[model samples]
Each structure stands twice: as C-alpha cells, then as structure tokens.
Target chain A: MPRWVRHRYASLVVLAVVIALLPLLFPSSYYYRVAALVWVSALAAIGLNILMGKAGQVSLGHAGFFGIGAYAVAIGPTHLGVPPLASLLIGAVLSAALAYLVGRPILRLKGHYLAIATLGLGVLVALVITTEIRWTGGPDGMPVKKLVVFGWRASGADTWYWITAGMLLIGTWLALNLDDTPTGRAFRALHDSEIAARVAGVHVDRFKLQAFVIAAVYASLAGSALALMNGFVNPDQAGFLHSVEMVTMVVLGGLGSVIGSIVGAAVLIMLPQALTVFQEYEHLLLGFLIIVSMIFMRDGIVPMLAKLPGRRA
Target chain B: MSKQSHFKTLFAAAAIALPASMMSFAGTASAQQTVKIGSVLSVTGPASFLGEPEDKTLRMYVDKINAAGGVAGKKLELVIYDDGGDANKARTFATRLVEDDKVVAMVGGSTTGTTMAMIPVFEEAQVPFISLAGAIEVVDPVRKYVFKTPHTDKMACEKIFENLKQRKFTKIAMISGTDGFGASMRAQCVKVAPTYDVQIVAEETYGPRDSDMTAQLTKIKAVPGIQAVVNPGFGQGPAIVTRNYAQLGMSSTPLYQSHGVASKSFIELAGPAAEGVRLPAAALLVGDKLPDNDPQKKVVLDYKKTFEATANQPVSTFGGHAYDGLNILVEAMQRANGADPKKVRDEIEKTKGFVGTGGIVNMSPTDHLGLDLSAFRMLEVKGGDWALLPPGT
Candidate 1:
C-alpha cells in the first residue's frame, strides 16, 4: 500500500498543479468555459472508470444518471425551491439509490446483456425528459438558475474554472485513495478472474453493486455541475450519444487508471478544436484513432507515452 | 517627489498604452475597408441541406457586394463553420468565429438543437447571430445579441391550423417527428386544438430513421372521424407518413403537412399517394406559375436559376429561409456601417421592410423573428408540383 501511494503521489500532485494554473493560459473566458466542460466530463468518466475499468462492468447508458443529476438541479430549484448546492447533493444521492435498485438484478447479466440493458436505461430517461414537456422544458431544455457560492454568483470564466478545478481535485484525490484500499484489490481480483476472486472470498456481487452506485452518484454530480455552470439543461445532454461518448472516453483513456480516463476525455474534447482544417473528417479521424490506438496500444495513450525513455522514443 | 512621480508616471503610461494600441490596431484592421460577417451552420450533418444553401447565399451576396465596390465602401468577408447537429460543436464553432476568426456578425443554424446550443456562445461572446432555424426558444428571452429571420414553429402551427379550418377539415389526426421538431409541433397542435375547433383524435410519432411507422398510422386510421392528418415537419418525415397513409386508402382525406416540407420533393417521394397533400409554404417559393409582373415571381426565378446552377438540385423553401436570414443580416450590417458587434446587433433588432426570398422581414426588439404569419401560402401538391389554393374556395 505504501509503495502504491509513492508510485501515484508524484503524478497526482502534478495533475493538481497543472489544473490549478490552466485558466492563466486561456486567452479568453470561452476557453475557461471549455475547460469547465472538460472537468464535468472528467467527473463522469471517473465514475464510470470505477465500474467499467475497475469492476469489469458494462454500462452503455450512464448518461441516464447524468441526466438525472442535471434535471434534479433544474427541478429541485424551480419546483421545490431547494437551493442549487443542495439540489446537486440531492441529485447525487437520488441517482445512487436508483442505481442500487437497478443494478441489483441487471448486474447478474454478463457482457452484451449488461450493455443493452444499460443502453435501454439511458433511453428510458431521455424519453421521460422529452415526453414530460411541462416539467423538463420538453426537448428545448430549461434555463437553470445560476449556481452561487459564498454569497457571490460565479459570473466569469475564471471563477468557474477555479470552482470546477477544485471539484476535480477533490474527486481525483478521493478516487486515488480508493485505489490502494482493500475494496480496490478485490475489484481488481474480480476483474482478472471472477470465479477465482469468489473462491478467494471476494464479495463480488456486493462490490459490483457498490461500485456501480458510487459511479452513478459521480455521474449525477457531474451532470449537475454542467447544468449549474451552463445555466441550462437539455435532452441532448442526456441523449444516447452522450452515453456512447462517456463509454468512449472511459476506454480511450487507460480504463484501469483514473488519470488515464482524464487524459482520454481531454484529448477527445480538445482534438476537434485543434483539427479545425480537416474539420469535416473529425468523426472519421476519431473513429480511426480509436481503432488504431486500441489495436496497437491496448494499454491506452498514457501507458504508450510512458514507454519512452531518457532519449525518448 | 520621486515616489509621487513614479506612481503618476506608471498610471499615465498604462492609460496611454491602452487606447493608443487599440486605436492603432483598429485602424489597421478596419483599414482594409470591408465589413466582416460570420456564418455558423452545419455544412455536414442531417441539416446540411439548409446550411449549404445559406453559405452559398451569403457568399454570392458578399461577392456581389464586393464586385459593386463593397457595402458602405467595404467588401464583405464572410466567415463560416459547421455545427454538425451537435450543440457542443455549435458552441465551439461559435466561439471560434467570434474569437479566432474575428467575425463581427454571425448567421445560419438550421436545426433547433444546434441553434439553441450556440445561444450561450453568442450571448457570452456578444457576437450578433442571425439564424435560419425557426425555433421560438432561440429568441424566447429576446437576448440582445440573437436575432432570427424565419417564421417560428408557433407561427407556422397557427397559420397551418387556420388554413385547415379554411379548408373545412376539423377532425385531424396528427403525426410528428420524434425529435425536438416533432415535440414542438405536437405541443402546439394540442394547445391550439381547442382554438381551431379541431379535435386531434389521434397522434402518431416515428423516429427520423425508423424503418416502419405502420403501427402508429394504423392506430390513427382506426380513429374514425380523423378527416385529415397533419404532419408538422417536412423532409423524410412527412414523405413517409403520406406514403403509409395512401397505402391505407386515406389519400382523399385532406392530409395537411407543415410548411417544413414545402419542397416539391415530398410529392415525388410520396408518389401516387400525394395528389391532395396540403402544405403551407412561403409565397416566394413554388410560385413558378405567377405572372412576370409580380416581384415575388422575379425573386423565385432568380433564386431557382442561381441555386440550380450552383447546387445542381431543386431549391426548396429551407434554402430560401437561409437566403433570407443571411441577406437580412448583411442588410442590417450595412445599415450599421461596420463590424461593431453592438451596433450591428442593435441595427438588426430595429430592421424593417427588408425584403428577401422568404418574405418581407421586419424585426424589432420584441419580435426578433422578422417574418409574419401571413408569410406562408397554403398550397396543394398536384401532379408533383405546388399549386396555390383557390381563393376562398
């Protein structure tokens, strides 16, 4: 455990400092806003990493939890008069509880069954958001009351960058801490060999459910953060493509490592902005990149980059 | 004395550098003597049909202005990008145009989803946006920076419902797209159902690419008094709905389709089943039979010739909406004299009597959308062409 901590400690500190100073480099508030989006997406991907990467579970419909988080912020404030901060917490708790109930029976299904069930769960949430027009603003999405902190509303890009950065830092720390714990070992063992882990006294079912619910809460909070930051929530945020994008981000980054997931999301999100000239070919290029990267470097970009030495390859 | 002078000198230097540098930079940028305009549209996606025409229209008009020695003594530099039916992408493109591309005014987003996504980008960047999309939500808050040039879904629904009443078809079955467009019309259809004294007895929905909608249409057919079926959106949606309805032997029941399907292609796609399909369209479009003396006729003919020669495809009303949106924004930018974001936005908000391919546009702070309900002409599809309905028939 001490050795594990020592190995990750330097990387964690480096990530924190880089994220802290990112806003200073941005030329405008727009880039800060984009950075905020990255943080929110990272939050969701980290949650899924616990399930897909850690526990070897499949959930193609994680956007459902994400939407629940967003809509909770919208519904809680406007309908129930709950404050935005509380609404975010309440949304997370609600999504976790729901995930616990949903994951119990469905988690038993292996592979494709798990994938399709999760996909259906996401679609069901989207259908509800779209159909319940009187509440969710229909497909147009409703504007959320802006999030406030310390008697001040975060009005500029710089403030939001700091706020989201703070959240990501705390989230990353908590996630990193989890990796060295006994639960983390059990999860790893279960992933490597489920039957063997069971024989070795791992509570596979309980741990799977727990990881799924915890990830659900994380996704919910991420969704709430996005809605609060943007001051709007739409069906598109919770749509099917968002679910697919989350899974893609999870895989693109080193799945087993939370840091890898972060790198994956940041690259995918910022790649489009960088490759503006061959803009039309973005989807084609990204698809090809995903295929080639997985085929050649199964460990993902981080592991591949780490392979280079002093006179780096 | 040294300390006081140090503070005074630093403050003076800061104040002097700010305006002096800005003035010199501004002098060089605007020194070229041309207005800079921005266009945000999906040149690639499902809605590219609208974006391509919008880009062509803006480029053509900008070229025409430059050839005539520029608008207000400056050539128009058009900056364009694709939204790709993704809101996040639209937001990114909006920022790029306003920040990196340094465009003064922006135009063109055909889908409600993309336009809504770009709203905050324009709001925060303070770039003036003129959209080809007709979603009411785009201008619902009436943001100072956002303006639309096309008729909205609400206006279309009211115009369409009133036209149906004129045709003496009250009991209507409704079919709508399963996406935002479908939901928008479905909501409007239900709300206005009581006003028009029309009962929407049955409503059926199908996803955009669904291989079969026979189940939903069959339910509508069983609803006995459904004298006509109303489809809110055009494109592949109404085309498929009409074909299915025809096979079910409801061809003569006065099927009403939204102005969205104003293209003559819907009739062709529906084939033998589309003989009596009623659609509300902009008067300027499918007015090929109008006399040469009419100004509307001239506009349509000129657009057709230019559009066909360019895109090598028949021009639909959506393309006309794009042409109107860009043409009107350019007119307003011309009125404002240069690319001052605030001046351009304010001038566009107060625009009036601006005529283009779609209809005469008159914008205001309260009404960001320029065209009125009367902009739509009720037409019937007869033998694969749009025919204006008989006067009070």
Candidate 2:
C-alpha cells in the first residue's frame, strides 16, 4: 500500500474512535439529533465532492435527487404498499436512473452551464412536488411512514445517530478508495483538462456520467435517511435553497477532501445551532461567519488545517 | 498595555466572571421554581410579519402571567427559537425545545407548513403543542398532543359561503393562486359551495409567481351570470389579482378575498383596489364595530391595546392566534394544577367557553381548534379600513 493510503487508514481509525466517544459528551437527546443531522449532511457532501472535487463538475440541484429520495420513502409505502426499507432502495434506484438519463446530455456542458442545467432540473422537481398535490401533498408536505424492521420500529435519536454515522463512514471509505482507481484518475485528469485526458485515451464522458450517477445515489440515500428520521418530507427538500446548501457544504469543507466534506457538513449544521445563543442577530452572525471563513480559509476548513505545522497530505 | 497582556487580562476577567454568574443563575433558578414553555416561530423570514408579533405576544403574556403571581404558583420561563419559515429548522428547534429545554408545552409556528412539520415531534414526545398556523390539517385527524388557535381554511370558506348565501349571490367565480395555501382553500371552497346553493360558474388558477392575473380574471369576466369573484390566496398574488380585476373593469362584480389576506398590510398592498373587497376575518380586525353584547369584543379590544402597545405595531389576527394559543395553554396548565404534560393535554381538551380575541373557544376530545364558522365575521374594506358588515347584509 502507498504511504498516503496508510495515513488515510490511520485517520479512519481515529475517526471511528472519535465517533464512538461522541455519545459520552452528549448532554441530551437533542445533541444526538444534531449529530444525526451532521452525519446525513456529511453523506450528501461526500457524494457532491466526488463529482465536484474529483471529476470537476458542479451540480447546483442535487436537492432534486435528494427530494426524489425523500418522496420515494414517503409516497412508496402509502401509494405502492412497499416497506420503508425497500422504499429506500427504490428511491436510490430511481435517483440513479434519473441521473443517468439527464447526465448524458447535461454532463457535456461545463461550469456555469452545467450548474444552470442542474438548477433548472431541481426547480422542475420542486414544482412537480408542489403542484402534484394529490401524490406529494403539495407545499404542506406529507408524513413519512416510519422504518420498521420486522416488528421492531426504527426510532430514537441515538438509533439514527449510529445508523447515519455508519453510512457516512462507509461513504467516506468508498470515496477515499476511489481515489486510487483508474476511473478516479480519469476523473482527475478530466477535471484538470478534458482535452488532455481525451488524448490520453480516457473515456471522459462515460466517467463524468458515472460520477454524476454515483453522486445522485449518495444524495438520494441521504435524503431517505433524513425523511425516515424526521417522519415527514416537504417540497423544500428539493428546492433551490437545499441544493445551494449541499453545494456550499462540499465547497466550504474543501472541494477535494472526503474528511473535509464531513467537517464542512458539521460546521454548517452546528453553526446555526450555536448561533441560537446570539438570538435576533443569528442570521447576521451566520452570514459574517461564512464570509470570514471564506476570506481567511479560502481552500476550506480541512485544507487549511492540513496546511498546519508538520501535517502530511 | 501590549496586545498579549490585554488578551490575558480579558481572558482572566472572563474566567472569574463566568463562574460567579453561573452560581447566581443556579441559585435564582432553584429559588424561583419556574415552568419552561417553548415556542418556535418564523421571526425573521418571509413569515416574520406573523412570527414577530407572535413572539412579542408570547413574551408579553408570559410577563403578565408572572407579574400576576404566576400560574399555579410557579413562574413561567419562555424558550423561543426562530425557525425562519424552514421546516427542517423548525423540526430541529422543536426537538431541542422538547428534549433539551424540557418545556412543558409549545405555543408557536407562524406558517402552516412549519407547524405541520413539528406535529409528529410533539406527538412522539407527548408534549402539548398549541399551533398558531391557519391550516385545517393541523388539527383534523388530530394528533393527541396537537391543537391550534387560528380558524381553519375550511371554516373560512364556509363563513364566506354563508355570507354569499345571505347576499343572494347564487353564482360566483373564483381565481386562486396555484400555491399550497391557494390550492387548499380553492378545494375547500369547491367542496362547500354546493351546500350553500352557491355555484362557482368559472374557476381559474394562476401560478404563484405570476405578476399578472389579467388572463385569469378575463376568463372569469366572460363567464355569464358570475355575481362575485373570490381570490383565495396569500401574499402579493391576491393584491396583484385585485389590481388586475379593477384594471379589467370587473369591479362591478364583487371581489372576495379569503381569510388568508386578513391583515391591514393586504389593504395597504392593494391600495384603492381593495376598497369594498369582502373577507371572513376574526373579530379583532374590527373590534370597535362589534356590539357591546358580543363576547369577543372585550377580549379583542384588550389584545389589540396590549399587543399594539407592546409590539409598537398595529394588531393582526395572526398575532391574535398566538395570544389565544398561549393563554389557552396557560389556562389548561392552571386547571391541571401542575405542568405535567399528560394532565395539561387533558385539561386543554376539556377547555370550554374560553373567550379569546379570535373567538369563544370550546375544545373537546375531538375538536382541537374549538372555533367554528361563527368565529369569523363578514368584514368589508370600507374606505381604507376594515368595517364589519351586519348580519343578513
């Protein structure tokens, strides 16, 4: 194994120890709820980073797939009589299919055009969810059936915290391992220069499409977890703001680092909770924090921390 | 002093001050014996107009209750969070309020969607939640721990249909926004129209973001025997519709707005176009016009005075919903003789003949809202202000 892979394995061990010890510090179940939220968001952010940092593509509307995943859990059981666990798989499959269909054409576009295409796609999903009042319950949102395994119901903030943490760890491991694969190298080459990558005999379009579909699956799974945990789903989950939030999580954490994506999710999710202490100035202070962080730590929280004394890549 | 010395001095001060403050706070909390009540409102987002006053009303009433020697001899501690009209934030805060803050009851959620999102949390936790949102579904198929103060969309439609029946307007036309609020009310209106012998001759829907409703209004105008035009929606959409109605020379056909537009801001937004437009609203909007025999008159007048003075703004029905919700919860807690969640929930359900700014609330095991179609009054915009239209007019 390479030296960097050895280092990553060490870091993963540390991460697992930290995750195991976090419950000891929780003052109440509310902390567990916050922890669960971080894990769910981290899962989505890692998926986004795969496309953005690795393949060098942007999706301003991952919330579209996220919403699809959420509604699948909500609508599948009541409408289609599918179990909640089965519906989660159904949501992921549906999101992957949608991504495959749309990614073929939209992935050809670069930068802002790709972003706009995804944004439009996300908006269209939100509109359908909002207007199809019969199926999706419109803007008032709909209740999601709880996840039940056999006779035992899946509940409690602690249960969700562990579940999401496990998923996030798996997602991060996959992303990290992908870094050494031929497809992963192709993605980086395309990200740096599509023409140069094409000359090197890499299947640029096929790799981009694969990255998009994988990211969509990641977002979809995260959305299913969120819906199942919250016991409800709304159109806002698919709206532009949520899409923007997902993008911000990937960028703010460090576009290229798996661990950075997780940290980014933690910071964004926990910052608002912490700012509650500021009361009426919460929004103002939150805006200031984002602005200052971007200015001082331009490469993101992970990259900046890695640059500290005696740190290794 | 040098920068390093100054930083050390500040840190030293904080270290000393924090423990001293903490000791005092713990002592006060132990001695006073307070009851914590949580609220989540959209205090700074699109629904701020609703949540801002609701927050003020909760603070004002909690202070008043404490000043009046507390409820059941325990001081009230209010824990409020601004969800900013976001469902995820509302759910997060709702859970925090229940688990971390250990609030006995909750009393706010400015919008229908936000309130709906928090319902399951309150249910699972077995905490009493008296919502201020104006959606029927918040109470219908009622969750055991959930109740609301605002009149529902179905009640609003029934009240309007009753007035139309009295006015002998058998045929009406409706143009509603395609948003959730509009869609819900439009469905309710259509469902209840036949009961009042009111036929909706023309029905059209406009997109939520549409600036112009001229096309929809034109279609409504061409429909023969359309006596009245009703726009059941919230936000600038209804104001735009009213302006377009006037522009199309359809002012001769009476225009009706749903309770969704029951605020002075709506009149201000519509300007002259809102003149003579009718709506079904809580008595608080026209308290002075209510007869002395009316039970709601005193409650409405008192809330208007106290809220306007405290909030430094005119009173609105949305604020009245918060006032009613908080007061009802307090009364229930007092009746239960303690802050035990299950006992308070039972007492709230048993609430009867409770006079509030919104209406005379009579809660039961089945009816969580406690108000009916009669809670609303037929109010018309006379000049630039609300004027109560007499019964049978």
Q: For residues B1-393, could you state the per-residue lDDT of candidate 2 as single tens digits?
A: 223322222222222122222322221222238899999999987779889989999999999999999889899999899998899889999998887788899999888889888998899899999999887888889789999999988888898888888889999999998777898888888999999999988899988789998988888888899899888998889999988888999899899998888898889988999998999999999999999999999999999999888778989888898999988999999999999999999999999999998899999889999997789999999899999998898
What are the clashing pairs of model 1? B33-B74
Chain A TM-scores for all candidates read 0.94, 0.96
- Model 2: per-residue lDDT, tens digit, A1-313? 2334235344455456557877776667887898889889989999999999899999999999999999999999988899998999999999999999999999999888999999999999899999999899988899998899989888888999999989988897898788788989999999999999999999999999999999999999999999999988998899899999998888887778777787788778877887787889999999998889899989876666555422332
After superposition, which runs of candidate 1 have C-alpha atoms over 4 Å from their true positions? A1-7, A310-313, B1-34
lDDT of 1 by residue, A145-235 (tens): 8887678886555677787778877777778777779998888888898999999999999999988998899899999988877777888
- Candidate 1's error at B137, in angstroms? 2.5
Q: What's the alpha carbon RMSD for model 2?
A: 5.7
Model 2, runs deviating above 4 Å: A1-5, A310-313, B1-32
Specify the highest-lDDT model's number: 2
TM per candidate: 0.90, 0.94
- Global local distance difference test of model 2: 0.86
